[model samples]
Structures are given as C-alpha cells and as structure tokens.
Target: MEKPKILVTGATGSTGAPSVEMLLQRGHPVRALVHKEDVRSTRLKNLGAEIIVGDMQNMDDVRAAWKGVKRGYFCYPLNPDLLDVTVIFAQAAKEAGAEFIVNMSQKQVAATAKSPATIRHFLSEEVFRWSGIPTTHLRPTFFSEWFLYIAHQIKAGKLQMPFPEDARHAPVAGEDLARTIASILAEPGPHINRAYQLFGPELLSYAEIGEVFSQTLNKDIIYEQNSVQSMADSMGLGGSDHFKDHLANVISDDLFGTPDMNDVIEKITGKGPMTLAEFIDKNRTAFTT
Candidate 1:
C-alpha cells in the first residue's frame, strides 16, 4: 500500500530538513515547502522530496503546497507575522482536507503570557485547534542548534549567552525533534490532538554546558553571562523589533524557572534524545578554532 504525502514547511531549517529525510526513509512521500530555491532546497530535492517554493503568508502558495498533502508540518521562524501566516496555513490546510498537522511551537507559551511573541505563539496553536483538524502540537525547549549559531564565540574560547548563569533547560537536539515529528507523521492515528513538551536527555545550565564544551573540544571555554539586550544587539537576528522583545521576555522567564529532563523524545522515538556532550562532539568542527 502507498503512504500518505506529507508537506513540511521551513523544510531547509533545523528540524524540517531532517524530518524530510526521515519521512523519505520511512517510505512516506514528502513535499518540502521552502521560501526559495536555495542550495538547501536543492539538497532536499536530491533526497527525493518534491520541493515547492512558496511563502507561508501567501494563501495561494500554501494552497498549492497543500494540494494533495495528507499530513503536514507547520513551522515558522520567530518573527512578527507568526499568527498571520498561521491563519493562512490553517485555512489552506482545511481547504486541502488535511488529515493532520504537526505544529512546531515553543515551550512555556500560554494564552496569558506576558510576551507578545509568546502570546502570538499561543494564539497560533489556537488557530490550529479551531480549525478542528487533527493536530499534534510539539513544544520543544531550547534547541541545541542555538549553540551552533554561536560557534565562532565558542571557537574563540569564550561563550556568551542571554540566559542567567544558573538558569537551565533541556536543550533539545534538532535531529531528535525531527525523529519525533517523522514518527508521528508516519502513524498519525495515535498522536492526533496530542500535545507534547519535547526535551533532551539531560538538563544543565550554560556553565555546565561550557564545561562539556571544554571537555569535548579540549579547550577551556569560558561562559559569560551577558544581558539579553547585548546578545540581541550583537546577533541582530534579522533586525526584528518584536523578536528582540520576545527574546528578552523568554530569557527573563527562564531566569525564574527551574529546568529538568523529560522522556518525550524517548517515548516517541524509543531512545533518549541526544545529550549536550554528544551534540558538541558530533559537531566539533563548529566549535574548533
């Protein structure tokens, strides 16, 4: 019997790219929706994905991508127009008669959230809920990929971040999250309407993580507790005002919270998610000077 065709948005990104690969390996047909025909999109096409270049905010583009997709993954970058694009995607998915959606959400997003960006995240999930489509919402904690982006700093023997020195969260790996997503899409019957908080195998603070980096990279990496504003100012991160505010609020929220490990990744994928040490060692080139 043939499998369902799945559409993955943000298909060139952290988890989306790997999820596309996993789905193809599982014998499920995949359609990758990307913003442009870049090298990343070309790679997915080489991996047997039917790549579609379109904007998530454009209804016509979404409808084109959703034309024959049964299951879909909705993942948008952290930007100001998250809710707006979510509405368009939901409407298009409904029109496409989509069987299920694997929604990409963040941890600690509640309707009563203080941050506008976090509130937008909550409202986006609500849009999918109101669509009445079978949806599996994945709320992952800090992604381990966050470290990779700052590899230049680590390579210089210094690591600076926005979160409190003692603050911590289970930094989930992109591949682990992708595996969970592909597993659910492969068999959507059990995951319908379910929401999961994804996490890595262990919880550790930035300082602890720095120690792991030191041991893995064989260098004494220093962890600096920098203000969120400074980090944002340095990273720029597309120059979005709302995203900077969101980053500040989320970091503040973490300052007052405790961290712990969860088995959601193991529950879904039959193995524990990757550890920080493993992630650092596996991607050592990024951290090596």
Candidate 2:
C-alpha cells in the first residue's frame, strides 16, 4: 500500500523537523514545506522528504503544496498574520479534498487572552473547525528547547527571567510533542475534531529549574529575578508591536500559569513524558560548551 503523503509546514522548525523525521522513519511519505531552499531544507531532502519551498501566507503556494497530499500538519510561525495564514491553509486544504489536518497551537489560548498571539491561535483553531475539515489541535506548552535561550544565563551561574522565580510552568519536550503529532497524522481516525493540551510530566518553577540544572550540570546555578518591564525592554518587547505583544502574553502566562501536568502523551503514544532532569542530562553540552 502506498503510504499517504503528509504535508508538514514549518518543516525545518523545532517541532516540524522532528515530526518529518519521525514520519519518514515510520515509512510514511512526507512533503516538507519550507520557506527557503537552504541547508536545513537540504537536510530534510537528504532524509528522503519531498521539499516544497514557499511562504505559508501565499494561498497559491499553499495550494501548490497541498497538491495530492491528503493529510497535513499545519503550523505557522509567530507572526501578526496567523489568522490570514490559517484561512489560506484551511481553504486550500478544503479545495484539495484534504482528509485530515493537525494544527499546532499554543497552550492557554483563548479569545480573551491578552496576548495577540494567543488570541490569534485561538481564532486560527476556529478557522479550521469552521472549515468543516477533519482537524485535530495540538496545544503544547513551553518547550524544553527554550532552555537553549537561557543556556547562556545558566552557564553564567544564574537563570534570569522577566517573571518571579517561583512562577511555575509545565514545559513539554519538543520530541514528545512531535511524536504525538506524527502519531495522530499517521492515524487520524480517533483524533478527528479533538484538541489535546500537551504538557510535561511535571511542573517546575524557575528556582526549581535552576536547582535541576545545578544538580545535573554539577555547577552552582541561581535564579536571578527581574521585573517584567526590564526584561521586556531588554528583549525590545516594551514597544507596541506584534513581537512585543506576543512576548508580553508569554510573560503573563509564565507568571500566572499553573497548567495541569497531564498524561496525554503517554495515553496517546504509550510513553511517559520526559522530565527536566532528563532534558538537562541529554543537552548538558549546550549548558557547558
């Protein structure tokens, strides 16, 4: 039997790249949608994926990429035009007679959320649902990959953030999220019209994260607290722009979020979620080197 070709947008991204690799390893035909033909795209091509280079916002490009592909993984990058992009992808999938779509969204997304990005995601999910398409939504929380952003701070013996050190969040592993996505894309029957809130096995505060890193890396790491305004100014999130709006929303979520640590990953893939300690152990080099 010819495996159904799955179209993966944002193919070179943190989640998309791993999802493509998993699909290929499972003997599924993968069509990777990338923005440019570069080393990353080359890597996907070398790994036996069909590469389609184009912008997601362009309907013609999306329509072209949707050709002959039945199931798709749709993910748009953080931008001001997510609603427009979702509309284009949903309409294209509808016209192409695409069977199932798994949309990547953020956790705690609601129309009332203060962040434009979160609200945009909430609206985007609606776009897919209203299209009358067989769609599944993956709403993953803070990624373990975010550690890389703070790796430098950790290496400097401190973990700095815009929020309080005690603010808690359940950060999901990127691989776990990708695995869940690929599994559903392979067998969309049971997942149709469902939204899964994916989280890690445990929730931890920044101070707790610092302790984990210190214990794992054999170094004294401390949590250095900073005001949200100062952090926002450092990252240029203080301005009234789309990026600032997104960052502010993230800060709000990080400070106030108390997400339930669910077993959705294990329920779906029969494997337990990865812990922060394991993440640190696996990527110790990033912290040290």
On lDDT, the candidate that comes out on top is 1
Q: What is the per-residue lDDT of model 1 for residues 86-184, given as tens digits with 9 covering 90 to 100? A: 999999999999989999997877767767777888999999999999999998888999888788788889889877667778888899999999999
Q: Please provide, for model 2 over 87-174, each residue's C-alpha lDDT reduced to its tens digit, 9 standing for 90 to 100.
A: 9999999999999999999887876778888889999999998999899998888788877766767777877776568777887888
Q: Rate the local accuracy (lDDT) of all candidates.
A: 0.87, 0.86
Cα deviation of 248, candidate 2, in Å: 2.8
The superposed Cα distance between candidate 2 and the true structure at residue 19, in angstroms, equals 0.3
Task: Identify the runs in model 2 with alpha carbons over 4 angstroms from their true place.
Answer: 229-240, 250-259
Best by TM-score: 1
With a 3 Å backbone cut-off (N, CA, C), the pairs that clash in candidate 2 are none
Local distance difference test, candidate 2: 0.86
Clashing pairs in 1: none
